[model samples]
Target chain A: MPIITIRLAKGRSVEQKRDLARAITNTVVEKLDVNPEWVTVLFDEFDRENWATAGELHSDKYGKGFGKIGSQEYPK
Target chain B: MPIITIRLAKGRSVEQKRDLARAITNTVVEKLDVNPEWVTVLFDEFDRENWATAGELHSDKYGKGFGKIGSQEYPK
Candidate 1:
């Protein structure tokens, strides 16, 4: 089960997201040889204030630190 | 920007998820005093085949390692 979260620049449409998801599913099905239905992807479109990097935030990435997404994970 | 992922037991209902999300958002809004709209959460549900813990995968946690989400991240 390879669920990947792609955080791209916002403003992407639903069609673009579906295309990305389909392409990813097809790649896994072809290369790793897995069923397509098992592949699930979710696109979370958030305002820049929801993500953060370093001491600054995505909001600050532009100017003011309005919103930011702190992308950190712990393997457990 | 603190985007937290809750890896809970599968089979949670849409209502349960919405409740949890709302609770979390409220907590941050109350305790941390963050904005509501700035809080974005996504629920990733799989058939115990898309998440991993340590060496064994979630699927292997049941039987075979059908799928695995190797939760790892780098502090950038």
Candidate 2:
């Protein structure tokens, strides 16, 4: 069994997150020969203010977007 | 903006987690002179089976602890 934990700012859509998880899980499951049930994935999402990039907080420093990912669906 | 991403297994108390975040935030704030509001902290909780240490998943490979961190307090 393997567990994958990923932390990224909340901006990507449900499709993106789900696809990312699926791709990651599938890669590890096949490579490590682990059972599907053993593969657990968690995505930690944070607001721009809570997350930072480069040298500033994503909110104050990078207002590239706002309130972007509040209604994203989680992929199973 | 600078984003710091950390990945760790979920077996810490709310106090512990809050304390950890506070310490981290205080460190960055003092050292970097950044505003407290700019410091956003997030904790992603996962089951033992969803985490891994050494060469095994946190669950099957290590049951040394279980249901350990669920009802702790989350400090502000």
Candidate 3:
């Protein structure tokens, strides 16, 4: 059994989480052909200070936000 | 490097967490022969509602408490 653990900045509502869990379960069941009941989606919420990228803490870089919109090091 | 993620009911103090991290890191270093810095120990705290065992929610079964001290399903 595959356990999918999602680590993200905590802000989503319960409805959003329910939708996410259902969608993820559906995707996994379709792709892996596993039973819906067997799929476990665990959400690990993290503070910006706990997450670091490019040797800089997200709290220091983003100042408490979920998306990586403006703090792009290289232009697209 | 191996990443160890521990899922548990959240109630431990900061000092307990610090000691746990250090002890785990040391154990990983000794067992796996990896660098201490390379071993990552992430604590994923969960509410009793989110964790289920034997098709029953922990919140409903145990109220609000940590440890399996009294919960003896089978005698040792």
* Fnat scores for every prediction: 0.00, 0.09, 0.00
Per-residue alpha-carbon lDDT of candidate 2 for residues B1-76, written as tens digits (9 for 90 to 100): 2233445555554445445666777777788888766665555456667877687876676553544433332223
Quality of candidate 2 docking, DockQ: 0.10
Q: For model 1, how does the per-residue alpha-carbon lDDT over B3-73 read when each residue is reduced to its tens digit? A: 54443335545665676566645544443334677555566555555556577666666553232233321
* Predicted structure 2: clash tally: 11
For model 1, the superposed segments whose C-alpha errors exceed 4 Å read: A63-76, B1-76
Comparing 1 with 3 on TM-score, the higher-scoring candidate is 3
Error of 2 at A67 (Å): 14
* Number of backbone collisions per candidate: 11, 11, 0
RMSD of 1: 15.9
Write down the C-alpha DockQ for each prediction. 0.04, 0.10, 0.08
Residue B16 lDDT (model 2): 53
What C-alpha lDDT does candidate 3 achieve relative to the native structure?
0.69
| TM-score, cand. 3 vs. native | 0.53
- Runs with alpha carbons beyond 4 Å of true place in candidate 3: A68-76, B1-6, B9-44, B48-76
How far in Å is the alpha carbon of B31 misplaced in model 1? 38
Local accuracy of candidate 1 as per-residue lDDT tens digits, A1-76: 4454544335444665576566645644543334676555555556556655676666656543222333321112
